[model samples]
Target: MPQTERPVSMIDPSLLLRPEKVYDDKPIEAFRDYSIDDSDPIKERVRRTYYDMHTNQTVDFVKGKMEKWLKFNHFKSTVKDALIKLNELVDESDPDSDLPNIVHAFQTAERIRQEHPDKEWMHLIGLIHDLGKVMAFYDEPQWCVVGDTFPLGCKWGPSIVYGDDSFKDNPDSYNPKYNTENGIYKPKCGLEQLMMSWGHDEYLYRMLVHNKCKFPKDGLYMIRYHSFYPWHAGGDYKHLLIDSDEEIKQAVLEFNKYDLYTKSAEVPDIEALWPYYEGLIEKYMPGVLEW
Candidate 1:
């Protein structure tokens, strides 16, 4: 797949995900080297949101949050309607990507289709992977809704984009057990034994698992942990994973090729692509996806 050129921005705050402290406390080199430019408005906005998410989320708070908000009532509308609302929110946040959320989904999915047509299941995964973002419409705060995801029970890595120093304020950071590299997990224990930060990825994974869809397990792992930079991109916390997680890890790595490489300005015609995706959804999912 070809790489998407990072868009330029006229505004002060770039809307891409990063931290305010990242700009203030650390050198620019400390941040991930993406193609995006400093002037990109979306980059700074994304940075502020990341700071909020990392600063506020505590282990126990996220756990209680999953318990309270994990029900299907959160997403009662059709997929199209949900996509429309999600796009509206994105529009308000970053006007540069004036494309609708559905457009983003179609772009990502169509790119996957063009690259690996044989992986039909992967095509569907790309389409709806971020559907759980509909949670934003339910009044969920942006901090809890999106940003980098990491295992809650394990040691938080300094490598995660936000200022790891700020995590000292998090209650879990004090728990002596969770502060270590291994934390609660044994070596190579696998990600299934881990609890990732509560967010859209896990919600969508559970939705697919509950429906028993024909999508590849690897694709599901991609949806579940794509935001898990600590393990995937940083190479931290691998010690906590078990042997079974190796399969899932390898699968996620495969999906990352498409995820990172597929974001391009060239978008597919939604009118033409909708039928294939709709059919795939009906074939795999039940009459109604609970949310």
Candidate 2:
């Protein structure tokens, strides 16, 4: 791994200034310049992931997964423990640099910490936002644990990654019940009632809710929909959302700047940073969680 020549504390979140700002110029250039058009290289890794997801993420598949993972009987882990363990996996769906995820965790936290130092809860949210992706570390395929998520039972969103090419293999793509816009859901059925495709976002959202973590609605929203690029980033799936959902959508959108933009070749000083995060963990979600 390449470390920045300057101290990591001065790392810029978005705007690149001096040449020394880039640890590896390639990913930073992609981060700064690449578009998500059909031809972009970012779509290369996303293609296979969405292909498998679109094919297998049927209503029945999501139901079966919800029954299993929703029980929250998987294992016991604290927030800190789970976030640290999340480092073991890499997100194939991510076009960003494939560093251990703890770097991203801290990178996100530090970015928020820099901008809104008073919103300590937001800082914690940034750090553990993708800790839900630990599902990949637990034998879950990269396709399921990480990706741009959309609702499973309803008609697929046009902005979903690989919107056309991938869903051809999906059974739901043909099933008349799921083919139409609105499918089984009523207009403005609300995101809470719908089952999103089984992924770490849903997993961690359920975990936090079940554990009774005293986080604000925004924090929870950031956790759940951070991967929901189709809804938040792509501007698709507005029919399913109610007025209140817009608040959460804005929160997720603001959170996305840090989550999507913070990837780099540089890593955080984990040893120096661990103590502060442990303190935050104790303050909020202390003790072993039945994750």
Candidate 3:
């Protein structure tokens, strides 16, 4: 069957899922390289992280996570404090960056600020997009807190980082109800309708909503789906989408370029830039918040 395409102006839908593919002068392929290399410690770490994630992130596991975290009871802190805590986390699943997650957050936000100068909400979205990784500080494993997320209770996408080999031991892969293309979802159910695997993307998205952060729907969409590479980047899951997901997909793709491609960019002066971002926090989502 022919594939459905995202809007052409956003990004070409024909590009192969190659980490080495260049965008904005940096080789993005070098960024997401998941090639198995026991000799390369970073590559090995990336492989192991995904293998663990794919192996263990089943429907029940995600449900348990939701039950645990969705209560917003984990802890309370301002957005800046939470983001600062990420300075201690190095995303084991990422091949391109070994720097503190805080750096990547600022890199993404600053890049967005440059490109879309007037959209202050988008700049904040870039800054806090991965802020949910603060879960690592609370005892959650990196497997659940980092990396790309796909819908649970559905056939794993072929474009997922490690693909089927990594999910060999996952019970979901063998379950008839969860392994089909449509899985438990009706046709045209839309991206929002899918139960995404437990990860920072969903955590932060929900936390924002729970705390009454006032980001617009597209900003929220960018936060929630930025790491959903299989749909926005790989063109998978077309069978499950409604027509409106097209706009959501475009928003995600727009935010995703800065999220992925900025890892190699020069780190911004995070301390210097804080005053501006702090104002944004006060304006949008201020004060101590529930986890």
Candidate 4:
């Protein structure tokens, strides 16, 4: 496996620079608010996206997606080229910013760059973390390609956005075998043991591994579990965690703050920023990757 040049500190969350309220100057607590508001188009879009995801994303559905995408046979493109394709995507599940996903990618990388000037690997991570959403252009829908992912085949985490109402129609919600807290997993099975709902997080993480990209374990963990709000952000999956997951949780939380808060910040000049990021891509994940 490839390794990052240096270790990213997960011990102190205080080390990461944070603004008072970064999402378009919204309050910190207001960033992820999922309150129902039919009158609001963005809120309604976010609601409908999750509703479609929760209703349709069954164990079978996830398995089928895995069988399809994990093959990595659809296309091959350089990391930079793949990221450029995200210029066409807007995460329907996000109410924070309607800008193309590429802007968010650069916003995320630039913030990480400003905060942790030495961790170039993390800058690349922030840029490409959502690159798995490129699946959207290739026959995949936004519902499964973008959103906060949770463990499937288990009782939905109460902290998941709209978990109370969105999953009511899902067949897995009613299955006796899958409705338990642990579901099909053993106690303390850890994060990797669970079948998290399919999304860009897992896909890009696995892409790194399969392609032998040189990123450290912590950077990879940040990519994989950053969207697992139910565990890292929501505090709902403790019963299934082991001791080491605490370290993983801290790494993810460190990354998550930047991911969530920077959505509405001033957009960075992506053209001038490309040369810097291209060098980082060359260093960490160069060459055309199978996707």
Candidate 5:
């Protein structure tokens, strides 16, 4: 059997970043109701992760954790069972969207489909983009499974919702080797050389890369770093990216606009859209993804 066919390990919560405060107090209603003409709720939620990330993340800490956890497989169970488990995790904290996790995923995908029928790859990307959220249901914490992803090789940005204030608690913040803007990296280096804070985005990206999925560059970028709002949206670490990275950045910029703006109160009937997505899935992915 392939290495990715094994079961993912149950992650330790102690290793995950902790939120400084509960986000439930924030006005997430506009985001939940999808009634906002302005305001980016997805960015807000992702920023909340940054708050925790800055304070709790360390170079050795995240590196050790990823080495220990990333090798594990997440595709041991059926996709249906995985989605069911993911729904349970969503239910624990997501009071806004009462819909099942699968339903929420389908809603996002269908919204993209309706807006751009020509972008069939995007429809599929939206459908499974959050599949990494299943990590929470599999015993991962909110920090490890979801959050704003950023490069580990440079200085944590002040604009990064959880920036320097939080990193005071982390040893790497003081480590000269990691405290610099180019910590552990050269100028204009590609993101592939940079390590991202551990989460579902990296997990799913790795799976797609390994499976050789024939997705558009934009779709692949969305999967790899949809949680990386700090660099993409906030312009926080643009200095670290090379020319090739900049081009890829431009491609995904369009994808992010659709992802953040397309949420709605009405849920998409998955049964109605499954055939179209399933065909796309079969076209791009193999009979079974490794994880």
Candidate 6:
């Protein structure tokens, strides 16, 4: 089925990002090398994390996680409360910012606020986008909750970060049935049917769905697929996208700029910023939500 949904009205959040984008964006004045590769310990850990993620995040693994996580019965908490809990998380998969996940949450949300002030849902999405990562602090390992996500059952696309050699160790890579392009999925099968690697993206997406969040689909799409580097950033997996995804793809791209490039030393004052976000949460997602 071609995912032919009506277009959503949302601002292009990426337009607000300046050309500097992120650190290690080659030619940056900063001497610190932030790009993911050898030598830098931070980037190295990120690489090793990706290697483990690519190795273990098989189709069955993702399905099992869905069975457990999609239940949304882990715990109950309001959106603001969940954000505070997320403060304890540090995404080992991210080579960019090492600050507490709470800081990054405010940073992303604040940037979106600057760009699209009227879109309170967008701001809220940025704030809680990685809230699912709190799963790391609970019981899940960093590998399962963080990193660039790609489809599990299909032939792993080449565009995934560290995909070529890193996935070589993955058991699925050895299986002839799963190694070919389009394995287990037909051409242009909409992403709705695909199983992305189990992580914050899917966790939070399903959480919102289970809670019956009132946010627009575009914001939901951004929350769900922000970590899908293979699809939105690398431009792979197009063969699998249906026509309706064109709208969603644009929203994801717009959301990506703020999510990826907004990391900085500037931290959002939790005290000062709490009120606005609280209202948005109350308006859109109030009360104790199922985890």
Whole-model Cα lDDT of every candidate shown, in order: 0.65, 0.77, 0.86, 0.84, 0.62, 0.77
Q: Give me the displacement of residue 218 in model 4, in angstroms.
A: 0.7
What are the runs in model 5 whose C-alpha is more than 4 Å off? 1-52, 72-74, 77-81, 91-100
lDDT for model 1 comes to 0.65
In order, how many clashes per candidate? 20, 0, 3, 1, 3, 0
lDDT score for residue 228 of model 3 = 88
* TM-score order of candidates, top first: 3, 4, 6, 2, 1, 5
- Give each model a TM-score: 0.79, 0.85, 0.92, 0.91, 0.75, 0.88
Superposed by TM-score, candidate 4 places the C-alpha of residue 217 at a distance from the truth, in angstroms, of 0.5
| lDDT of model 6 at position 56 | 89
RMSD of each: 7.7, 7.5, 5.1, 8.0, 11.2, 7.9
Q: What would the per-residue lDDT of candidate 1 be over residues 144-257, giving only the tens digit for each residue?
A: 766667787667865565446547567777788777777777777777778777777887787767656677668788899876766776666767766677687777766664
Per-residue alpha-carbon lDDT of candidate 3 for residues 133-166, written as tens digits (9 for 90 to 100):
9888888999999988989998998777767888
- Per-residue lDDT value at 58 in model 1: 69
lDDT of 2: 0.77
Please report, as a residue range, the 10-residue window in candidate 6 with the lowest summed lDDT.
1-10
> Which is the winner by lDDT between candidate 4 and candidate 5?
4
Which structure is stronger by TM-score: 3 or 6? Answer: 3
Rank the models by lDDT, top first.
3, 4, 6, 2, 1, 5
Off by over 4 Å in 2: 1-29, 32-44
lDDT tens per residue, model 6, 1-291: 111221211111222233554443432222222234476788788878878898888988888888888887788888888888887777887766789898998898999999999898999999999998978866898999987788877787766665467787888887877777887888899877678898999899989988999999998999888888667656677788899977888899898777876675477687998888899898999899999
